[model samples]
Target: MSDKEIVEPLIPASGSQKIDSATKRGRIQMILLLLVCAAPVIASYFTFYVIKPAGGKANIGELVSPVQPFPSNVIEENLVGKWTLLVARPASECKVGDDACVTLLHVMRQLRTAMGKERTRVQLVWLVTDDSVIDPEIAKSYDKELAGFTFIRMPRDLAKKQRLMTWLNADNEQSAIHLLDPRGDRMMRFKTGEGHLDFKKMVKDLEKLLKWNPTGKVGD
Candidate 1:
C-alpha cells in the first residue's frame, strides 16, 4: 500500500446530506417565522372567544350598558363632571325615621366616606318625585346624615316632561341607587330592597373606576 492508499483522500460531503441539513434548517426557520407571525392572532382569538375577559366584570350592580344620557336639568344641576350616586325616592317616604330613606341615606354616606379622598369627586344626590311634599324632618335628616348631598326635584310632571325617570330607568320606588360616572351617564343600578346593595363592593368598584379615570374620569 503506497502513501496515497494509506491516507485516504478527504471526501466532500454528500450533496444529499448537505441538502437534507439545509432543508432541516429551512424548515426550522419557516416554523419559527410562522409562529412569530401567528402568535398575536392566535392569542387574540383565544382571548376574545375562549377567555371572554370583558364578560367577567367584577361589579356587583347590573352594568347599565349604553349608559343613559342625563336629562338637561340634571346637567344644569351640575350632575356632570362628578361621580354621582342618584337616590330616587318619593318625597312622601323621605320623612325622618322612614326606614327606607334612613337606610338609603346611611348607605350613601357610607359609600361616600368609603371613597376616602376620592370622596371629593363623588356626590350623593336625591331625586324626589315631589320636593314640595318633602317632610321637614327629612330635610333636617338630610342636613344631618347627608350634609352636602344634592336634592333634585323630579315631580311626576317634571319627570315625564324631561323624561328623567325614563332615561334613568327609575320608578317611584326608592329601592334602587343609580350610579353615574363623571360624564353624567348612568352606569350601574344597586337595588336596596333586594339585599343587593353591597356598600363595600360598591366602594371597591367605584375606587377601581376612579383609579382608572383619575385625570378626567370618563366611563362607558
Candidate 2:
C-alpha cells in the first residue's frame, strides 16, 4: 500500500472522531445548563424532605413525590411566576353558612395573610368545580381586586373538566388544599376536614417555603 492511500483512510477516521467529540461536548453543556437551572429547586426540596431542622419537624403537608404540573389547556395562565395555593369546591357547596366549606376558604385566605410581606409571592386560586353561579356575596368576599384571590371556573367541556379534576385530586383528596411552586408544579397538599386540618403547621410549612424560595420564580 502507498503512503498516500494510508494517510487518506486515517483522515476520515480523525474527522469522525472530532465530530463525535464535538457532539458529546454539546450534549454535556446542555445537561449542565439544565442542572444549574434545577439546582436551587432540588436543593430546597432536599432540605425540606431529607435534612430536617434541629427539632426534626417534618412537613405537615404531604409532599407529592413527583409534583404534578398545571393543566395548560384549562388554566389560561399556567401560574408560572407565583406560588399557588389551590382549592376546588363547587359554588353551591361554599354557600354562606356551610361550615366545612367556609373553614376551608377561611384557612386559604389566612394562609396567604400569614405570609405578611411575602404575601404577594403567593396566590390563592379557587377552582369553582360546577356550573352553578357563585353567590354574589361569596364572590364579593373573595374579590380578586380586594383579596388577591383568583377564581377559575371549571371548563364546560367534560373532558377538560375531567382532566383538571384528575390533576387536582391526584391523592383522591378532592377537598384538600394544594400548593404549587413557582414553576407551576403541585408539590404539596394539606388535608382539610371537620377538625383534622392543622392551621399552625400549615402556616409553618408555607412560611418555610416562602423563606427558602423567596424569588417566586424557579432557578432565580
Winner by lDDT: 2
How does model 2 score by TM-score? Answer: 0.86
Error of 2 at 214 (Å): 2.8
- Cα RMSD to the true fold for all candidates: 13.6, 4.7
lDDT of 2 at 202: 89
lDDT of 1 at 100: 71
lDDT of 1: 0.67
In the predicted model 2, the residue pairs found to clash are: none
lDDT of 2 by residue, 112-178 (tens): 8898888888888888988888878878988776666888888878888889888877778888898
Best by TM-score: 2
Evaluate model 1: give its TM-score: 0.63
